[model samples]
Target: MIKAADLPQTLAVFPLPGALLLPRSRLPLHIFEPRYLQMIEDALKSGTRLIGMIQPNPMRGKKDALHHIGCAGKITQFSETEDGRFLITLSGASRFRIVEEITGFSPYRKCNVIWDGFDRDLGPEEVDKGFNRHSLMLLLERYFSARGLSTDWDTLKDADDELLINSLSMLLDFKPEDKQALLEAPSLTTRRETLVTLIEFALRGGNSEEMMQ
Candidate 1:
């Protein structure tokens, strides 16, 4: 396990919207774009293998404006396909806050990141007190029914609280801003509540755009 002290001060960031990677979670990505391919090569050669996964602000123009907070993931699985694309899985290590953007040698964006604020991510998952697991499960059933989604109930039943929350938070088709809100939630309790509220609103026939507003 990588400690907070081992994390780098600067990180190469991938500005992708609606992609959420939480600490201890794994996100698989396909690197095909020339710039990102170069970024992957550089990371492998440099042996950092760290990439900050952040959401881009749609309100901003073509510029690479990103959310302040993001999770830094280390490349745990890497393979090159026959067609020149890189298939890799990143294991989330820690969350970071962007102190500032810096000019970098690589075409991909780089930012000076601070990990002190999110050092908790390096530790074990903290269960939120007073979390109503039953209610959440019930709501998830309704949400899935309404969305016509199916799942393996047996497998889902065996998942721990943190995995359940983070997996749903990432895999659910929530708006990008809502996903960002989930990522920015100060604690697991708040994140759980926020997710429940969003599901309730959806059940009430509220659209994501209105809920966000």
Candidate 2:
């Protein structure tokens, strides 16, 4: 776990909607865009290999229009490909709220972030607080069948509660807003409840577009 003092105050952000990374979870990214390629290079060169994972507001056309909260991740794995693209995996370090955006010279945008509100993210994953995992699994079974998706239940059963919840929250085809809500959930219990509610709504044939509104 990274110490709060060691975390950077300012972070280079990747505004890719629907790509969610929770603390201690891993997210793999393919860097093909010139600006993002530059961002990776700068991250590698500098000691702080941290990058902010944020979502751009779809309703806004401005390049910098972003959600107020995002998670910071450190480059844990890196490999450069032959075509000049970088294949990197980030291990989430902490969540932050955007204090302010820094007007900088870099092609990619930077922001001054505050991690005070999410200090727990730096600690170990919380134990399950009697979250209804069985109900979630039942909903997932129905949801996957409805979508014609197959999964290895055997492998899934081995995952810890935190991994299971975070993985599902990140991998499911939920709306960007829904994903953001999960990311911003104050506690694991709350996150679990929110996730179950979203799943239940989807199972009941609720329109995601309507739910977002």
Candidate 3:
């Protein structure tokens, strides 16, 4: 079994938009692009087999800048398709802060990441005592109705606090910046709050693009 101490400081990052891979969660990725396909091949050869999933910064001027915070996930499952694409599942490991981006020979981005303040990520699953799951479900009902989205209600209801929020945060059709807010949230409680706020904002017909401006 790999421990946090075994994790490397330098990591390969996948700068995707609206992709949130929280600790203890699983993220499914389809690698079709040439750079990312190469990234998977190289990661499979590495010691940790982990990849940091970060989002591009949402600034209007700095379009290419990557976010400072991201979650690192272990490549727990990997499969190759006949069409020369990769189907991979990343099991969330820890959240890391980007110290700096490394200019490397590889086509994909790599970074020196610090896991200093995210010890909680590697610990046991977080418990949010005050989370109103019912209330959130009510809002989600309306929010989903507004967007014509459908989900397995029973599965969602059965999930614990951390899984429910993190899964919703990742699966929801929110703006990349809104998803970033959920990723950077310090705790499960805070993330639920952010999720609710986004749902309410959407219910009120508040456009995330307009908010980003």
Candidate 4:
């Protein structure tokens, strides 16, 4: 429900590594950390209710701890638990580029963001011209079997192109760097290709997530 123009120049970001949220998708978060809990409360009071989900790339050093590209998500729903923790869902709005880190304000990290070149994110759902559901499903089945993971095949079969690709991209157990690669993919087709490539790599005796830097 957030327009591209409505996206603020500055945004509070959740720098959690290995968490990914793409446009039109939803990310569920359990916030217990004092800073993040405060962040949730502050976002509730703000007009946009938007929060950027970024990955902390330690390999990049503190000056570039957070990956430059991240997605801004709107806090669509939230509930406070008895333990003072918050269970919330963020609906992905649009991807952004961090212009600079805004320090010295709140406990959580804030950054100036640039929303240019992401207009296509707000439009209708993208159609993957090269999406072959059957192939993907076969690949997923083998991948799941190898990992001892289970999924609802009926549901996945029913999912559309964008949902199928984006959901898998968000939910897969890829390394933070691989997930970042998925996030930075220019289009849905590219994302799907990247995902397929990752899966293929994993199935072919590639290094495991634990082995990656």
Candidate 5:
């Protein structure tokens, strides 16, 4: 595992299937299951309250599955209701690669992780503006209109690069492999290209029914 100079000692991790998180976004999670309830308690007690969210691949073997990339989320805000359930809000942190799952842990799973430098600046580069962003915005408008969903366009338009990419990645009806590809994308540019292509395909309106297929 690649360790950063300022790496924290421990992290809270949640192993789930089909969930992805990204930086600068809020992941609101409901913690009611026994194992996850314990995870929350351990995180709060440890004072870090950070959760590494990763998903398993199609393979059933825990040791043999899971993509290499995932986002780390900090437990920014949480509340335990009278019913003993946890309502927690997660603020996205840096991305991490799970070197391997650590053994000898009870209740919650633990893994040795290496930071993938997602927070580091790749230097200022020109964003794709020609046909990509423009076409995406138009199709996005139509897609939302067709679904009868209301959104604050002003807010979405003003979102920063990371927010825009991650938000769209999370909400879009992309296939699992496509979603994993976005997660594994080395740079925002690559991720954006994948998204633009997907949106363009969606805009064509022929294969829209196969969103998950």
Candidate 6:
């Protein structure tokens, strides 16, 4: 019998090269890899189907690995396909750090983790009487224009902070380092500043990765 300690306190960890999952958001995952598929199975059997979603530092060598910060998500909704694949929805839970990966887990990767010490405390609210909000909307309109893409602005304007941030983070093809910075920032103000900086760089046609540094 595999003791609870024998396995990582966390059931599964999914790593993406440039994605960040933050609290109060949702991450949709389509599980296909054999290891990760098994991970989903194990998580279903466990009490908390919480998975840590993180990104690898691509600038590091192949042998080098992921950054230290990530978010834990509870598997709130899931559907298994007839072909044995999983389409799952993860609602953000809290942040965590990998203590270490279990040495020889076959068919799945598991790791011990410590929460990033988030007290679930909300951050200082900025009264967005809609200036920065409008600025963002305008910039996004122009940003998408050059790429010839379109979105429903009326819908976007009504989205709450969590929706606004998560949607933008997922859709934007930001550099890996910038994504990591957003993940590790302690508060919303910091995250917002980092994003503004990125937008300014994009307006100047500067490389996103360079702006991160």
Per-model TM-score on C-alpha atoms: 0.93, 0.94, 0.94, 0.95, 0.79, 0.84
Q: How does residue 39 of candidate 1 score in lDDT?
A: 83
Could you give candidate 2's per-residue lDDT for residues 20-74 as a string of tens digits?
A: 9999899999999999999999988777689999988766677659999999999
- Full-model lDDT for every candidate: 0.86, 0.88, 0.90, 0.92, 0.69, 0.70
Looking at model 2, how many pairs of residues clash? 0
Error of 2 at 198 (Å): 1.2
- Relative to the true structure, candidate 3 has a C-alpha RMSD (angstroms) of 1.8
Runs with alpha carbons beyond 4 Å of true place in candidate 2: 59-63, 208-213
Return the lDDT, model 5, position 169. Answer: 82
Among these predicted structures, which one has the highest lDDT? 4
Count of steric clashes across candidates, in order: 0, 0, 0, 0, 0, 0
**Which pairs, if any, clash in model 4?**
none
lDDT of 6 by residue, 10-43 (tens): 5467778776677767778898888888888877
**Where does candidate 4 have its weakest 10-residue lDDT segment?**
204-213
Q: Score candidate 6 by TM-score against the native.
A: 0.84
Indicate which candidate wins on TM-score. 4
Give the winner by lDDT: 5 or 6: 6
- Enumerate residue pairs that collide in model 6: none
Candidate 3 weakest ten by summed lDDT: 55-64
Clashes of 6: 0
Q: Of the candidates numbered 3 and 4, which has the greater lDDT value? A: 4
